[model samples]
Target: MRLIEKVWFNSHPAKYLLVPLLLPLSGLFWLLSTLRRLSFKVGLARSVKLTKPVIVVGNIGVGGNGKTPVVIYLVELSRSLGLTPGVISRGYGGQAPHYPYLVTAESTAVEAGDEPVLIQQRCQVAVAVGSDRIASAELLIAQGCDIIISDDGLQHYRLERDLELIVVDGQRLFGNGLLLPAGPLREGQWRLSTSDLVIYNGKKAKKNANQPLTMTLAATEVANVQSGQCIKLLDFIKLNPSVNAIAGIGAPQRFFDTLKTNKFNVKKQQSFVDHHSFTLADFSDFDDTIALIMTEKDAVKCQGFCQSHWWYLPVDATFSDVDRALLTDKIKALL
Candidate 1:
């Protein structure tokens, strides 16, 4: 992790000096964000409500709280409920040819962003990417979608939402509990109460009054990045007792820890900044004999140039029966 992130998430001594230095900037960020939200509330800024109900799955913190997997789970749940769901994302780290690009079988991560492509490929749903989420929602509506799911836009007040689901990194819940620059949060902890539902990624918060739901990312299988062959995670571990792991997600340590939990002998692990564009040169030094494993998100960006030994573990968001029923009932009510 970078020095700033270490101070944000970890209990580093640098926070005593670094946080004080960045407090002014954090105050400014809070002021601007508050004003922007107030603008929408008071009609200075327009907030568009789409024809279909829009569910926003996001977090207050800057890093990944396993929102993508939860999004995929929602898409599948919507399908099971006989509703067609579509996703809209900001397409961070991707410069598409135009606005509101629809993800297709041929769409590359470079064009549609990694998470959008991954969702489209996994759920076979209508996924759109652009800065203008309203335009993206219109595109999905044109495609006959009955419901809209915003991948990560809780703070995007301009696009009005029917339901807001905030995912929290339960283990690292709002480090320092301060705003950006000084902490990892984009908004304050109070934002959680304003949200419709709070989903804990790993564990539920002890003192939360919202009666939050908890979800766990369960590893299902490992697949070759180059080929389409897949095998059970344990089977792959049996074949390759020791492997090298790499992750480019916001919380790379979570991916590494998942591997360890699955009993994989991780020989060496590497982490990169979130949404990092991978190249063949990035893996030049890895020993080809031992398997190289990565998160499914990273695999999406590396598939075109991946070696035969490169593999990726795919995880699914699993929730308890009561939580699933409650979530389903909430969605039904919204519909």
Candidate 2:
């Protein structure tokens, strides 16, 4: 883990001593972030309102909070209601030849961002990626998408959104509650109140007047990264109790925990930084005979040199029927 990431995700008594040292920088970040929002709010910087409603799925914290799963869920929900949904992402850790890279199942993670490509493959929806989200949204609009879902751009004030869905990691809910280098928060904790909805990824909702909806990442199946063969997670665990688990996501422990939940004995676990580019050399030390399990997101980047032993676990974000109805009704209201 990187130094900042260790402090950001993990809490220690030393953090209280070290966090104060970074407060000045965090304060400056807060000022700049606040001013940027004010620029749009005061009309100094204009926000473009698209013809279709845009639902933004994002988090105030820096690392993963399972926003992509939420986005996928929204897309599926939209389709059930006869609305075609498109996705736009900032394309983090990806660089394209040009702007507005449209994603397809065949699109490489290098060309389209990993999450966008994953979404395209899984949801089979129109997905576009670029730093300029408006341009990406325009491409989706041209592709006959009725609703636009911006992934991980809650603070992109330039793109006016009808609904803001903020995802919070139930375990690491706003660590330290400070901004930037000092803590995990991208914006102040108060930002939650301005959001249309708050979804807690994992853990049950805390009882409060405005209780946030809860969702859990449920393992669905395991697929061979090279051949596309799939098996039930339970069956996979039964067949191979001792396996090497790998994750290249922002929250690697979450993936490891899921494997444990399914009774898989993860004999060896490796964690790479978020969106780390993988090479065959990275796995040279691993025994090719042993089963290697990875997250679906990481599976995209390793397909070129993946072995038959390599497999990935695919998971779905599951919510209660009542919560699903509430979220669906909220989106329909925007339509």
Candidate 3:
């Protein structure tokens, strides 16, 4: 992680002292964001147009609004629309691809990032990861991609987008309703107002929204790692009624809640900062035999050092036809 990101989340009171600096930092961010938006407004930095259209699946929350499944849905939706789509991601925890580079199934999570690799495996779409998202889009285009679908980038002003979809956790909505160091918002609420459309997986969209989409994942899916195969969700419940659950996501409880909904016998839960690089010590204090279920994002980092009885339940989201029509119409209006 970058030094800045590391310090931004430190909960020490001394870090709170840095909030004053956040005033200038936030102002500068807003200024840069404003100037970039103006450039698009006046057509200074031209947005590269795709032959088909571009759809971005993202949210303002720092993490975990079920963005991955949404991206997968876009891949399938594009195919259904008879468009060949390519996916772009910033590769937050993966190797830093200085510019856009194509991802492959053999790509390691450490090299290409887990989410992008998972997307590649699930949708069989061209996947690229880099900081310069616009350049990545061009790379995908050069390879004959008809449309571009960016994962987790609504505020990436560099990438000009045709359609925008925001996924908000029904529970968090907006954490503390503050921006940046003060809270979890990457951009303000008004950004949603200006977006082409909004989708609330667990949250409701504004009443004035021209269109809205809602999606939910299946109760469970198979977890594949190591040589271990086909562990039933019920198996965990029957064996450990007072087991501990650990998660490192924007909302760890969300994962825990899903497990409970599936009738897991969880008796305690541990929440880690999102993208936490787990250490051996993290598991030392836990009951050695208790099952450890984690999100796929976290599983990327955990796979190598995982202890006993570890598994990650993969999730897939489903959207209704009505919501699909609304989303398609919004993209059509922009295209």
| Per-model TM values vs. the true structure | 0.98, 0.97, 0.83
**TM match of model 1 to true structure:** 0.98
Tell me the spans in candidate 3 whose CA falls farther than 4 Å from its real position: 1-25, 96-98, 239-242, 328-335
lDDT of each: 0.91, 0.88, 0.73
lDDT of 1 by residue, 98-195 (tens): 99999998899999999999999888899999999999999999999999999999988889899889999978888888888999999988888888
Question: What tens digits encode model 3's per-residue C-alpha lDDT throughout 1-335?
Answer: 23333344434454455556676767677777778879987988776655556788889767778888888887887787777789999887787545677898677677787788778866789999998788888889888888889998787766667888888776667654556765567787777777766777755555755366677776555364443465566664566565667788766778888887777777667878776767778877677666666777666666677765776777777777888787666655644
Error of 2 at 259 (Å): 0.6
> Alpha-carbon error at 202 in model 1, in Å?
0.8
Give model 2's clash tally. 0
Deviation from native of the Cα of residue 249 in model 3, angstroms: 1.8
Worst ten-residue run, lDDT, model 2? 203-212
What lDDT does candidate 1 reach at residue 120? 90
- The true-versus-predicted C-alpha distance at residue 85 of model 3, in Å, is 2.2
- Misplaced by over 4 Å in model 2 are 13-17, 207-211
Clashes of 3: 2
